[model samples]
Target: MRTSAREVAVTAELNLSQVRALEVLLEEGHFGRAAQRLHVTPSAMTQSINRLERDLGVRLVNRTRHPVVATPAGQRFMHQAVRALEASRAAVEAARGVGAGLLTIGFIDGYSQAESRLLDRFHSENPDVRAEYRQLHWEDQVAALVDGAVDVSFARPPHSGVDTRLLDTRVVTVEPRVAVLAQHSALAQRESLTLDEIDELEVVTSATAPAEWTRWWVIDPRPSGQAVRYGPAVSTIHEAVASVRTAADSGSGHVLITGESVGQRASNAGVVFVPLVDAEPCRIELCTRRSDHRPAVQMLRALADAACSARAKTGRSVQRGAEPGVGVK
Candidate 1:
């Protein structure tokens, strides 16, 4: 039976969900992982792929492999699928009314002050735009952005070269590093410490965070050419703090290295913060996907820049006043 071109076009048409499922499936290379990324069950992911293949009349995936891979035909279709999704995203953004729709913002620890200031400005300027906030861990920070789970992020620059290539960042603040020690620990009473001085003490590291990030934060190799002693591996700041406190109580002499802002904000009485005067400062940044061009994303970036500039000017003014032989005229 001969079919009209219109009928053929209608028969082969794919919806956004189907395309998205295929995209994530290929990226993740596993049904369960892809389904999890899309917030669907493994069976649903299988069904989605099956439906796509049924509609297109071609086998899209080769399930024989350990990590499933797309067939050649599926690979060819993926290029178009990616372009289609991108165009669809752009169209939706363009079609949205000003101050309408939700914008999800992600933030990591140690940026509460910056996040609050930025949100205050955003709320004032965009009273009608609904905003949602999510806390991100160091391990999944960039992944959340790449997965389209968040519109923007307040984070430190990623230590992994791969992540660095995926994000665009605007430096918002440069904060000095500090050592978090248990209150009873010997280092707790010190006014300040150098990286070399702490190299012998066991440093807490993350279990799932990128190795580069953990290495940089802990100063893996001491300035004196000695290797750092690693202690407990934690997944979150709260856990890290608890580990330090426990170690201190047990006389284990464990430490957590982090930004000064975090140390100032820590409410746990079990820990004390000491400045790492000789270590490099941490750069807090406002980050977003390099390809995201949505209006809300742009607005957040502009507001962040403005807020950072204002803070920088205020810091300079205060520094000028504190300098020897200098005062407000």
Candidate 2:
């Protein structure tokens, strides 16, 4: 008797990683590339495919080709794998009650002060609700929120070239942008500089970041319409700083643009921050998916708004020499 595709039983239990590997391999069409995407070695990717094929008792990939091709059975299995992964993610969200029990928050590196304050307020109001933080890279900020990897994120704005119709944002703080350069660099001696002065210097950027996002961060086109020079493309904040330091050490000028808070927190020995007198201020916002209307998210958003308002009021009060309020309302 012939068994249907759904009726076929596997000899071994397949894990989510294996399913994800198969999906990525098919999408990338190359073992090495797939391995890189999944942060695994090429040999590990090969072994995973071998195990998957062994368990399923069918050849899933045609390995003879330069760019791999999925076999007939593999193509059919791929469809199911996609659905299976989706179901698995849904099950996890369901188990967590989608922010009812746990609220996973994502934040970019060097921008944790505001997140910590917000979490403090959230915890005070929500004693029983569990919350955790995840550090996100510049390129993955918006994607993390959209993919449900985090319930919410504290990140910079202009998610450029990304579809954010399903996302919502609230401006938490608008801080000035600063230029980061090597401590030994000539520019570090200057107290402040304008964008035009740094326009000629190469700017460190992310390799995988959206073009518009990178442009905004680097302020690509100046008021004079000259294009900003691009330097080494880095994947992380540390790499960017290292590139700048290396260039500085070699007597070559390189710069990185980041928020004032991040610049002030630079603990790296060779890095120094200088205020950008003419640059646009960085807008740090609380980003959340529009589809997620859970109470936990709403509470966090309200607290963010209240905190921002209180800070603004306090700043004005201090400027006017008046006493500020005691706690967040």
The candidate that wins on lDDT is 2
TM-score of candidate 2 on Cα atoms, chains taken together: 0.67
Give the Cα error of residue 95 in candidate 1, in Å.
7.1
lDDT of 2 by residue, 1-329 (tens): 97655544443234667877887676567899778767899999999989888677899999897768889999888766765666666566767774577888897775647666887888998898887789887767876775578988887767642345556777666677888888888788999999888877899988887566787788867765777788888888778888888898788999999888776665488988899898877667788876566687888888877767776777721121111111000
Q: What is candidate 1's lDDT per residue for 168-276, written digit by digit as tens?
A: 6776666778899898887789999988878778898988775666777887666788877888888888888888899877767888998888877765988898998
Q: Kindly state the number of residue pairs that clash in model 2.
A: 0
Which lDDT values do the candidates have, in the order given?
0.73, 0.74
How many residue pairs collide in each prediction? 0, 0
- lDDT measured at residue 307 in model 1 versus the true structure, 0 to 100: 64
Q: TM-score for each prediction?
A: 0.70, 0.67
Q: What stretches of model 2 exceed 4 Å from their correct place?
A: 1-95, 311-329
